[model samples]
Target chain A: MNLNNIYELRWKVLPPLAGVAMIGMAALALVTAPTEVIEGDVQRLLYVHLPSALASYFAFSVTAVCSILFLLKRDFKWDSAAQGAAVVGLIFTLLTLITGSLWGKPIWGVYWQWDPRITTTLILFLIFSAYLIARKSSSLDSDKSARFCSIYAIIGFLDIPLIHMSVRWWRTLHPQPIIAKLNPALPDEMLLVTLFSVLAVILVAAWFITLGVETELLSQRLLKLRAIAKINISEKS
Target chain B: MSEIGFLFAGFAVFWAGMFTYLVILQVKIRNLQSQIDLLENIIENHDEV
Candidate 1:
């Protein structure tokens, strides 16, 4: 197979490669640290929620990339990729909420808290959901839907950094960016493991989005082919 | 009584969820491939006539 086949490319190779690395990082975390004095086993929630959230951001960023490409190239494949990533990003957003809530029960003493980070995350989720809805309104012309979805996708990407900065801009209890490279607070081991986890999930996200886009395109191709076949058979009869 | 244990469980669930999704996608792609193949065979047979 030629390099043009995504299956033959390096980026496509990342899922399995990163999967192994993630498992290794998990092992490192498992061995190096003692149980937290307070959150106990629950403290592990940090690793899950943070990485999931980061992966969600990464997915939306890819959506923006695809959306721009679709508009510039006028290629349907890029638009399909944007749609695929948006759906996956939305799922990861929900995961972030669930695991965050699970962690909150132990640390914040409440199952739900209206923290800055939490609120922005919720908004981000809603925006993407709306993006999907806009993509499939059924009444719009195909060209119109593609245009609107592309526009909405660009809007969604612009919202991500605003979501991140909201916690600092407002006096919220979400603890002001726990992980920044310039001035770090968490122990190096913990931070490294968490970063590794983020990278792992991002690879998983890319693999998923690529597969999804190809599947959707294949379905469309199938539908068109079948319709043509039916027409030809009826003409013969 | 460790922060790390919760940490471990979180990672476990996340990885498991992603892996399951990947497996599901694999199955779906296989199914679609079969459908496409069958359709193509029908079209080819019809053309032969």
Candidate 2:
């Protein structure tokens, strides 16, 4: 098939694939994974919590890379991609905060604390949220806006490393990285489910980014077409 | 609330957030698509003229 055909095929295929993977992951988390003795069923939240955090990291990483590419190439395509990834990253960050809060209420006995990890994550969310708003509200032209946002995104990405190392760098109520060690803290089945959850969340995040990029490109196209139509009308008159 | 309640709430919050974002993106995409279609028609007609 040609490139357009392949593109159309992906647009049609990805949504259902993401949906199925998510359902399968949920089943594994809820049914197949063993319950923790101490935390019991509440431990199941880790499946979604950890995966969403990782997915947000993935999305923001995409944004940061695309932002750099946009600066190097001065290509609007990279800017569009960076914008798409940022929006997806923001949504996932919001989900991480909310779910983490829910998970915290039970384990920590408080919905929120000034813990290092949580504080840094909240900062990440706020930075991206401001990035999106600034993209819309800026008085700059399109190219300048993209350049500004790209710089902002790269700077904002510095927070991810901080959030990742927060648990290690300082004493906090938050748990350290479970899967990052040579020997993971989770049992075999739980680890398997968590891995599957990460895969499913990443698939969904990819789908969202694709849709977001399409929307951004289409909007740009529409603006160009409108400008052309204005010229045509002015010439006719 | 109980442990089960928190578990359910966490999952519910996740699904709700994902679904809401998906809906918003879909709506925005649909609107842009329609606008593009309208502009394309205008440009094509102008070209024909």
Who wins the lDDT comparison?
2
Local error of candidate 1 at A53, Å? Answer: 1.2
Model 2 Cα lDDT, one tens digit per residue, A177-220: 43222223788888899899999999999999888888777777
For residues B1-49, write the lDDT of model 1, one tens digit per residue.
2444445555666767777777877887788788888888888888898
Q: A112-171 in candidate 1: lDDT tens per residue?
A: 766677888888899999998988664322766887799889977797678767754674
In model 1 chain A, which range of ten residues has the least summed lDDT? A175-184
Off by over 4 Å in 2: A1-9, A139-141, A162-184
Positional deviation of A154 in candidate 1, in angstroms? 1.3
Enumerate residue pairs that collide in model 1.
Answer: A35-B2, A35-B3, A36-B2, A36-B3, A40-B2, A41-B6, A44-B6, A44-B7
lDDT of each: 0.74, 0.84
- C-alpha DockQ for predicted model 1: 0.47
Q: Each prediction's DockQ?
A: 0.47, 0.83
